[model samples]
Target: MYITMEPGSELAWELYAGIDEAGRGPIVGPLIIAGVVISGKCMNKLSTLGVKDSKQLTKAQREKLIDVIYESARYIIIAEIPPHLIDAYNINMLEEDTIAYLVSRIVAVNSHLKLKEISIDAVGSSKQLAQKIREVVPKSVRVVIEEKADRKYVAVSAASIVAKVWRDRRIDALKTIYGNFGSGYPTDPNTRRWIHDMYSLDPYNPPPIIRRTWGTLKTLAPLWYKKKRQTVAGREKTQKTLADFLPKI
Candidate 1:
């Protein structure tokens, strides 16, 4: 992808890449991460499209932008992590690693582009996490990770839309198989009600789609598993006590 730096002497990069994510909180669908890369030439077109944070836009607005991004961006990359991968690696760490890898892959593909800087809508926005991302990315390329970067940078905003669009579609697919649970957020009444119904029916084994490790499910454990845990604890304590060892002397 033959790219050149902006005409001005002050600019340093032939390409700019932005990274953002979606579905970090939803319980039912894969977490989607997206990166959008554009030349300085395409930046104005993106701005004119009025890109902003994905949450602020309607579903229709985001869908429209997705097409615009694909047409305008020099390169785009997406990563999706399912429940099993999320369960294996922590969500936050997984997000961090995924973002780092995405940027690296973009740079690798467009080596001639000479990326000036990478903009990221950081998942948790911590210094240590930012450092970890920097560690994996090429040192020649600068990385600027900020909270709410999607709202501030057009590239990041486009990535946010791409990620959200993919997540929404995946959720729709899940709905067909699992039935609608209203966005799959814990705060959603439909999701909560569904959890209650399913847990009551089979406390020992909830649906595999449910993230059993999440605190939302753990909070409900008192309803069924608490008593069994208590009984096991009581037995262990009694067996370890000096009085039990004395044997009715």
Candidate 2:
């Protein structure tokens, strides 16, 4: 009573997919990778909807368009990589693997839509990334990897918006639990203070949310370590001074 369907065949509509990620550089929070597949007509509609690189849009603007994007796209997929995973794996390799997985997942789930091409905002070596993606997707599907493709392609823009919004939400949740960490970037002074404060609290084990392997920890470790030694030395000196002031037994 059921019909068997083969993937990537008997396509009714041709669609283009765009992939993007957020939170790659932040020393905190998970990495978010997103892909959007939309029909040709919907791609135009997305452009008309004022979709651009998520960086250009305000948080309010991105939130407003997120729903419209979901309604307009034929398919969308998002993947999250936690801090521990990122620390354990090479970032470039993790991104490539996630990109390939997202592409394959989209194809498998939306087999009816013939994906004509995929455009991604490249992480590194566009040529190599494109080759890696090409190996996973159908031959007919063109792979376009370029820096700032999010700004040039509406689909990529949509993906960027989705990824950004999701990462922001995750950061907000982390804030509720850990207090404000100031954008979670290593460059933020507040983030640096938070890292130092956390280190002071427990030098051995940091919160699970923090990327322990980050260079920030190493950079801050020595400073705190020195301070710790100085504090102990100061305490010992104070004790000796007190002993000398008191009459010996």
Candidate 3:
């Protein structure tokens, strides 16, 4: 990759990368993380496309821009975290680790690209998240973590669009099998109603797509919450019994 630095500039950034996520708060779909890298020269084209934060755009508008983003990006990386993983782990840590994974992967695969900076839309403490990323990325690379970075950086905004588009398609595919759940947000009445109805039929076992650990389930169906607790206790007891049988080392 051709690399250049402005005269007397300390930063010789040749390619800019941005990272953003979608479906972080949704109760139904997978969390989508996307990272986009574009040469400094191509960034003007991205800005000209009129891309903004994905939340500010309509579905049709995002769909229209997805291809353009793909065309303009030097590299686009995406990852999907399933609902079960979200339920089993701390979401904030999961996001942080995933961001590090994406950044490391991008750098490893495109070692030739003179990538210098990465801007991420913050999910938790910006300082902590940057620390996690810095541990894996090259010392020369600069990590920028900011609240609402998607709104401020065109690169982050493009990443947000890519992640959002992927998540929307995944949700649509799920709806074909599970029926419309209306955004899979706890605050969405349609989503709550669907959960209520599903739990009414089978309180002990939620649909595989839904997050079993969500507080919304406990509120809508106490029976489901009770059963989940009981199941967890059973697993713990079984593990203890197995430990007892094992010879102490």
Model 3, residue 194: C-alpha shift (Å): 0.8
Count clashing residue pairs in model 1.
Answer: 0
Cand. 3 Cα-lDDT: 0.77
TM-score, cand. 3: 0.84
C-alpha lDDT of all candidate models, in order = 0.71, 0.77, 0.77
Using TM-score as the measure, the top candidate is 3
lDDT of 3 by residue, 151-237 (tens): 988889999999999999999999999888999998999999988888888888877788767777778977654222323522332
The 10 consecutive residues of candidate 2 with the worst lDDT sum are: 1-10
Model 3 residue runs over 4 Å out of place are: 1-13, 226-249
Off by over 4 Å in 2: 1-12, 222-249
Task: Report the lDDT of model 2 for residue 90.
Answer: 54
Which model, 1 or 3, shows the larger lDDT?
3
Question: Scored by Cα lDDT, where does model 1 land?
Answer: 0.71
Q: How should the candidates be ordered by lDDT, best one leading? A: 3, 2, 1
All candidates' TM-scores? 0.78, 0.82, 0.84
Backbone clash numbers for all candidates listed: 0, 0, 0
